[model samples]
Target: MATDVSNELDRADNVGRIVDSLDSRRVLLGALGLVGFVGLWWAGSTAQPEYILPSPLAVGLAAQSELASGTMQAALFNSVLHWLPGTVVGTTLGIATGVALGWSRFLDEALTPIVRVLRPVPPLALIGFAIAWFGIGHAGAAFIIAIGAFWINFYAAYGGVEGVSEDLLDVARSLGVQRQLGLIRTVVLPASLPEITTGIRTGIGRCWMLVVAAEIFGAPGIGRQIFRASNSLQVDRVIAYILVLSVMFLLVDTAFRVVQRRVLAWR
Candidate 1:
């Protein structure tokens, strides 16, 4: 009788696991959502002139043409060279500054005022400085992106540390890790990871938005490509570039999610 009961329980657990599996209903639902979205877009385009609202196919064709002409490649390379450097510089500096401020009361008090004053200013507002300093090239574009990324990571790191529980610090102390660096590594850093990751993800999207604007400032990139297309009234190319930009951002977001899941697998 006990053997029979155990078999029944095991079968029930297996059934539950199958039902809760990720690729089952979740994949189906996600596919359905994409279909519905594209269907709505198709309907909307059908109701408008192709020039005003190009169909997905039209944009795809434009993308093909751009790729064939090497326009897409050049623009992508130009944008990447600057955007990547800026993000790296910004994220690194912001995290370091934020951690320092969070860990030390003196530093927090000394820096908070200046950070607050600068934080409200938009990257666009700093274009003059960027151009003056970097001479309207990749360096200028990178500087703009860096300014945006810095703030995001800074707040992420700062808030993550601030949000760590006092109990966690106590636990670290009890573990005989009383030094500041040890406390950060053993308690504060781990405890604050979720918030820090959130900040990085948020920054990724924000930086992409800024990319177009940053590129508009005499930089040779996707933004310039779109703008130049508009000069000749090539709305199809404009739409295609917009689609390309969306795809790029989506890819980055997906990659970040994958990395995030792996890093936070413990949770």
Candidate 2:
């Protein structure tokens, strides 16, 4: 037992070391990529008018100005307002429905057809209804965001739970856990959690992508700000806001990864 524990610790240490090395490489590569991208932008701007394509320096300056003006902060707040609620509602509902469908034959039979029909239609395609119902504000944007996230997590949870091994359930049954609900809690959920978490990660990224389109209607957000800047021919502000969106997504995704690693630590 002592030897086994030692071996396990050694293996964990090695995995940790490898992960650290990979993270370092990722950081270095990301920095190099950013530098190359900026260099290209600088070159492009030098060749063209600022209005057409702002240089990296011009964008940086505009970003600083936006920060000082606090308009960007307000936009960020508005974006998060819808994004947070939409993601939460969508993920919660998706998990519940997915777990139900995966566990219960009746639910699967009842909802599968409806889900199939709805799944292929992009959430943005429902923008007309969203605007008509919610009148193009934060609620409308959030509704659209929720629709996108719902399907992502829904499929992830459904497939993940359905994929849990029958052998695990058999063993649990032998141990006197008979009810599907109890079995779900004891075996299925934990076994399938990695996939569920992956769905969450995907949902988050999807919501970010949809937030832009969601705000196309008069909703106040970074996406709308990007649209406004573009209309005014303020290419620098548009680029700056686009960078802001990227940074926001990066931060949120990184946070989710941390939580996911902790949740999946049993693996």
C-alpha local distance difference test of each model:
0.87, 0.92
Distance from true position, residue 95, model 1, in Å?
A: 1.2
lDDT of 1 by residue, 85-172 (tens): 9888988888888888988899999988898899899999999999999989889999999989899999899999998999878987
Poorly placed runs, candidate 2 (over 4 Å): none
Kindly list the per-residue Cα lDDT of model 2 for residues 1-267, writing each as its tens digit: 999999999999999999999999999999999899888878889999989998889999999999999999999999999999989999989887888898888999998899889989988899999899977788889999999899899989999999999999999999999887899999988988998999999999999989898998789999999999999999999999999889999999999999999999888
Tell me the TM-score of each prediction against the true structure: 0.88, 0.95
Q: Top lDDT: which candidate number?
A: 2
Question: Which number leads on TM-score?
Answer: 2
lDDT of 1 at 135: 84
